[model samples]
Target: MEISSPPRSNATDLLVSTSSDISHLTELLTAAGLELGPGGTDAHRPPRRVLNTPRYAAMQARFDRFGSDGITMMCSTAGLQVCLDMGERDRVATRWAALHALGPVLLAVFANSARLGGRSTPWVSARTRAVLGTEPARTRRGAVSGDPAAEWAARVLDTPLICWRHGGPDWTAPPRVTFAEWIGGALPGVPTTEDMDYHLSTMFTPIRPRGYFEVRYLDSQPPQDWMAPVALLIALFEDERVVDEALAAAQPAVGRWLHAARVGTADPRVAGAARAVLDLGLRSLPRLGLPTDLHDEVTRSLDRRLAAVPAPHGGDLR
Candidate 1:
């Protein structure tokens, strides 16, 4: 997952595995002639693809109309997308909600990309801002419920498509024209099943659900450290005991998505919650039987970030 989407400096992004295999990933990138962008994911990256078809360029044009060239390029954000296994499809709904809320904690821990468009910014991950700010209805999540599929379907219908089908005099709809409205005869023609599927694909939320849950929000990191966040999240989700503890500790961060993007670990509460999650993640590593190198990377990352945080006036908490 390219945390740096529609990347600011380049026309391309690093295609990462949805799973965590740091060394295999390095080999793949090397083979593909791609190098991980230096340091921060969104900082100092050059200005930069989409579906093929006549609609592709039109889709890009609509994105360009909304914000920066980087955004249109869809290279402004990147993330870790860990997939939770689905047993007979209905099983993972609750976990989906858990991951949605826990997403911010991951962001707080791996908050890189302090600069975007080659300009310094206060935010740790400008990539997060670019993604959530893209189009509220689509980019930002709507309502999540116990029924993940139903909520997601409703959200897909509720969100206005970025551009209408190409045959119209103007491909853009009047502001807030939802796909449901188009299906209900508000648009001149009927919306096909294909149209519905394609529109859903454009809806980028902090977390998205397919057969597996897609955890989005952590910024793209350097190759050496990128695996830490992935390992941490996997440790939490794969182990049920850690999941409970992580969720309880991560609760305070549920709605701090925007704040996490802005102040990142600088926000004391975010740092505290992230540390708790990381600690829990560390505890699970040995039992999870993950490799030694991955264990070290996660430990080092958690220690470095938590150590950067100053001791409270009373005392050190961790």
Candidate 2:
């Protein structure tokens, strides 16, 4: 599933093809005790041990404390997670901010989960709703300003620890204990650099920038449509001018997370923003070096949605 150099001419096809191959292999294995598993955003089935790993067991125990919302996200939700390189050093902050700014537009366009527990829900993406309901200290995006790395560092230190991995199965940290507190000797043991690295891994912000940007806002699409969104993302960030255009197009809907997940494209501002970005992505496909057939595939898939968005309105999505 690794693309050594991403956005390669057939990168989207490569990813989708790889995913299908894995799914086929998984289907064969399901003849044993395993099942291919549920799709969409949420399935209301009660949590069970799918993997018997120690870290997973410990993390599940911690999530249980956050109530139904946290538990629901931990056990029931899945997404189409995209990881992109941070790009050049100088433009990294700009790219990071642009992605966050465009999040609502992209999310609105791709919102797929409309039901939970076998009943229809109001939200377009119930998966996002579940995440919003989870503990904000860990789940929400970090404030972006000044230095991207510094802001992220401060945010990480300020977040409450989910669990501290001890050799035993009970990797629970004391309630409400922040990592900064641990560093300042507020807890019994001295924390090390390794502990900090593990703590970084525990934070679940929407756009996590490790060595690369881990885009987590998009919902899981139906199998046939997954490639479209990936292609759109590749095109949107194809160059700096397009990135700026994207940011401007999405500005009206920026930070409107609740609106995006609820009504999605039904919200006029969100719809307009989505349309603008979709147009930009489609046009940029040629410059992206995608094959003519792939360009046509992405365009056809996205154009249907574009045709549905209303023209831009002055009202704020929020």
Candidate 3:
């Protein structure tokens, strides 16, 4: 399941592919019996009540084999996560565009891991919850609006460094200190400009607007379905019409990111946006030469989730 590198180009027309590296990681884990079930166990049972040692051993063995590298594992502070390489020049812009466009689609595609603590957590994507909980600056933010590169750079420079890996726990600083502050000599240490730059690189948010915006929001979708989000994102960005339509449809759910992340497709606004986005996606799929069946699958899933929204206790939609 090795993911090939994307074609070398900053052209909007380039079809951005989903990295197979993540697929390999997930498959290895699953093959080793590390099933990503709701709460990591079956219904009517407490989570982690039954540990599978052999499965864990297999996973450890696999990890030991591949090991780590810069491109292989970015932002160790945010955990070993795979980030798409969008070349050098427009890295942040391309990453941001891909992330924002693909966020909801990925969320829909990888809507497994619904249960937590051996109980349904009302979210269809609990793995996403675990990701966002990784670090504040990296995973907490909502969508971005404006030039991707400048915005990303500004945000990164302003976000305080949570910790420097070198200094350990003793290197901690005031909670609100920004990278700018550290560079301005506000901290005890006479931090260099290079230190500021390095610190900025570590911040991870769901939709980072760095040189290439990274979509850190999706759960580990099934390997087979991995291409769905990638395809949807490429189509949406490459086609201006699709981008406009998706933006229009997702507007209602703009400020409700927290609600969406918390309850997933359960919330009416989130569900509505999901439906709109899928419908728009289906209409644009033909232009991209992608199979209509994929769009249909997305549409059906959204419809099913929307229909499953529980009736209000008092019969009110609110």
What TM-score, over all chains together, does every model reach? 0.78, 0.88, 0.61
lDDT of 1 by residue, 52-131 (tens): 44455555666665777335237544555555544344536656666876777777667777777678877777777777
Tell me the TM-score of model 2. Answer: 0.88
- Per-residue CA lDDT of model 2 for 235-290, tens digit only, reads 78878888888888888777888899899988887887787788888888777666
Sort every candidate by lDDT, greatest first.
2, 1, 3
lDDT of each: 0.65, 0.77, 0.50
- The RMSD of every model to the true structure, in order and in angstroms, is 6.6, 3.1, 9.1
Q: Rank by TM-score, highest first.
A: 2, 1, 3
Candidate 3 versus the native: TM-score? Answer: 0.61
lDDT of 2: 0.77
Off by over 4 Å in 3: 1-110, 117-119, 130-138, 142-151, 165-175, 188-194, 290-318
**lDDT head-to-head 1 vs 2, winner:** 2
Over 1-318, each residue of candidate 3 has an lDDT whose tens digit, in order, gives 234455534322232333345556667878897643322112344322133343233322322333321111221112112244444553434445544654654464346556544467665655555555545455466445456566666777777665543354344445667777876876767777677655765665666433343556655444444445554555555555556677777664555544565666556665666767666655655565544565566446444544554432332112
Q: List the residue pairs that clash in candidate 2.
A: none
